[model samples]
Target: MSVKHDWYQSEAKVVITVLLRNAAEKHYAVEISGQRVHMTADDYELDLLLLHPIVPERSSHKAYSTKVEITLAKETGVRWEALEKPAAAAAAAAPPKAQAKNWDKLVSEEEKVEEKEAKGEAALNNLFKKIYSSSSPEVQKAMNKSFSESGGTVLSTNWGEVSKEKVTVKPPEGTEFREWDK
Candidate 1:
């Protein structure tokens, strides 16, 4: 199900034979590092979809059975080559320090922006609490009643309201009849 090999550059040829469970095998001629290698299947299970269905009566009578054969084409020329000298040297060289500096600056700016946003949110919350507390006692009572009935908590000091659930629901269907029965 999986293939693993050592690091190979662009041109590599390897021949591998995999033994399968169903007595079916596959041969692969792979090009590894510009070399062509031939691999033959060693007792590999054949894919059911690729295999012909066996007729039990005919098979019993026959001395030999038919098998499916698959051939894969190989690249004639050099499939892989080593990287050019100049490009390889440049890639091996150390990267510029400016990239790291820019990344650090970006991170610092993001943190500052997040801090400002959090401060603004706290200020807005405080303003809301002050306004809610300064309102008339009747308004405060009404707000508290609404908050409690809707599964919310109204803080005493700040008069800030926090609700457990955001959504409101309407009475269920046939509630009038149910109420009458009760």
Candidate 2:
């Protein structure tokens, strides 16, 4: 059989339940430290280091048919934000040891110039889109259809650098159109 344990906290205390199937009642032992809870069931031991302080004197436990329930009194009524300290946060909190800097991995002057040029191009493209969207509805619809049909790579010839041209409208001419004309 394997030993399993779970823990939860209430307004006043933290309760830990250990599942020990087919184990004798006298075979379990529970202990508490200033900020830790330890339990032994059959041959298995569980150690839980609490994030907050607890009152060992006020802590109690009860053994049931196949489980042991331990209640640890909270030193303060305030709820604990977490049960255990996060290992990643602890590692990040520590100041890194100073090391020699590597100049080879740094960004080159040419790359900086290219990055600035890319930003300027992006800003100009945004301005062009704003101007196109604020144009007349006919122009917007023609541009939308042109862009959709050509995957936006084919530019609209109606609008040029210094002049705005009108879109040519053509009626559909086919057998299906003649039948629908009725």
Candidate 3:
């Protein structure tokens, strides 16, 4: 049979209740350390690393006919922010990967590959945002209007000096312009 646990916090202590139906006091063993808790019986074991520091001397447990109730003293008399660190962080910090399941391989391998591809797409989108913000007001207006319409394709603008006829030096009075050979 599997053991289930429920955790609750109060002003000064944290309470954990473990369901061990019809269990006697002799069949259970409980150990509480600075931030760790270990409880075991003939059929099951439970080990927990608390989120915050607790006073081990003040922690106690009592086993009843159907359950075991454990009370742990909070070091600072404050509520915990989280029950435990994230699974990924704990798995990375611990020496062994064996403690955590290889969920990526268990699920679809195709989705993992797709998620990596999506990161690249996200980077490209960020680049577009940068370019859009740096563009001129006229360009921004045109872009906004096009986006509001069905679709926008091209940006046309005169970026350089207007075209004009090339100027030539006037020939001396009454002298014809002569082409010179190299």
Candidate 4:
């Protein structure tokens, strides 16, 4: 005896129930929407329900009891035409102007040059002061020695050494050697 299968049995709007079985013989049920009228025996897999049309002459009694898979129609979310005035207004706000390509480079170069020139002038002034100061010959010799060792005319010594006063010897009170010996 031959059995005849109907295509309308799997048509759209029909809900299909699938049973899932694991290695432990546990069964899980899942439902899927069958919008298409055409379905085939090969279209169904283990726990998967074909919701769309398939080729003709396919059996509908196929068993799918392993894993259930379902496909649903894509949904349209948040239509742009329905947006409120606040969202449109924010998007309409003017954008900031584009920056000049070389502006920052030019500014940084000018600053570096100015800094170098200022340092050079300060160094020259310090060297002039050390060479012409009214300090003692010993201190002057020391400054010149340091300048020569550094290989540059700029005098970078600390102000304390350059401005220190020379120490002078004084006789102790009530202890004059010349008078005490007599």
Candidate 5:
């Protein structure tokens, strides 16, 4: 069930005020983790993945007859744009030209895939993505054509070589690749 709630943040804390009448300790429950908040009052529920990290150990909630107020101590003094992280993430997805994601220290899409130390298939994929992203237009086109025409069995960055001929699928040893039936 939907319950009305108001959230605000100060330099030191984030406050969530749930409008729930007859709010009691037994009926209303609030749980605070590192950056997550889960509150329940009878049939109503409120969950928030906070925009910023909060000191869960120092957080607390008070229940009153008309409302239940939760106070979460902020780990840092950063003001939040939204009560939940998802809202903040969506807003950050399309950042302003000059203004970037420093507000949240959020990682870029490319950064998310490029790990510091990758291994095996992950490393290969990351390498391919990196190579493709940084390659010249000709190289990119060559790579795309080769990879696709070869059924993902070939990935070539040499435009001169790849453009000369159609890439034939090179199946791995012990594996057979057959054409799909019409």
Candidate 6:
């Protein structure tokens, strides 16, 4: 009879479960070397080439009525992709051949992304905010003073120029700056 088996793992250990009808029978023999697991019984045969070396002295197995559980402690705490070498290879398929990228298509994609960004008053405010956030203390001070005193009309980053004069309210063309009622 064909013995069905499945394997799972953690960071430190791997457990292989073998499904057999008469698991309680003591006719099974399990042998473990550095990188191999061999088990045999009356009508069952399980042989596997482990993906990585395991601690032979620390490996063990227990038999129950439903299944036989084999526990193997890994020699190193490395992440295992699969229980067997061939399984690991099959899980990771062969890579595709490298090719040059399409430069024109890539450039058009980048331009389209830029076009999607806000280009109105919000974008201008975001630009000024980014500059102010990354600038030095003096530049931040100048930007704060100019933007507040100019009635949202001007934003200056030059501390030397801004510190020399008082920023006056200069509203946009056709818009007049008026004081709030106090």
RMSD of each: 22.4, 16.1, 18.6, 31.0, 14.3, 13.6
lDDT, candidate 6, equals 0.78
Q: Write the per-residue lDDT of candidate 6 for residues 81-112, one digit (tens) a residue.
A: 76777645534633221122355799878856
Give candidate 4's error at residue 170 in angstroms.
Answer: 40
Q: Write the per-residue lDDT of candidate 3 for residues 89-144, one digit (tens) a residue.
A: 45544332113234457665765555457667686565556567788876565545
Q: List the residue pairs that clash in candidate 4.
A: 12-34, 12-35, 38-54, 47-67
Q: Cα RMSD (Å) between model 6 and the true structure?
A: 13.6
Clashing pairs in 2: none
- The candidate with the higher TM-score, 3 or 4, is 3
Query: Runs in model 6 with CA error above 4 Å?
Result: 87-182
Query: What is the C-alpha lDDT profile of model 1 across 43-80, one tens digit per residue?
Result: 22211110111122211110112332222222432442
Better of 3 and 5 by TM-score: 3
Give lDDT tens digits, candidate 4, residues 1-182. Answer: 11122111222222232333341243322232232222222323222223233332322323345533233331222222211123344345333211213445888788567556766777666556746585766766656655554444334344456345432223456744243357
Q: Which ranges in model 5 have alpha carbons more than 4 Å from their true place?
A: 87-182
lDDT (CA) per prediction: 0.33, 0.64, 0.66, 0.36, 0.79, 0.78
Residue 155, candidate 2: how far off, in angstroms? Answer: 40
Backbone clashes counted, model 4? 4
Give per-residue lDDT, candidate 2, residue 98.
Answer: 17
Predicted candidate 5 versus true structure: per-residue lDDT over 22-65, tens digit per residue: 87843878889987777776777766666778999999999888
- In lDDT terms, which candidate is top? 5
Instruction: Give the clashing residue pairs of candidate 3, or none.
Output: none
Deviation from truth (RMSD, Å), model 4: 31.0
Q: Candidate 4: lDDT of 138?
A: 70
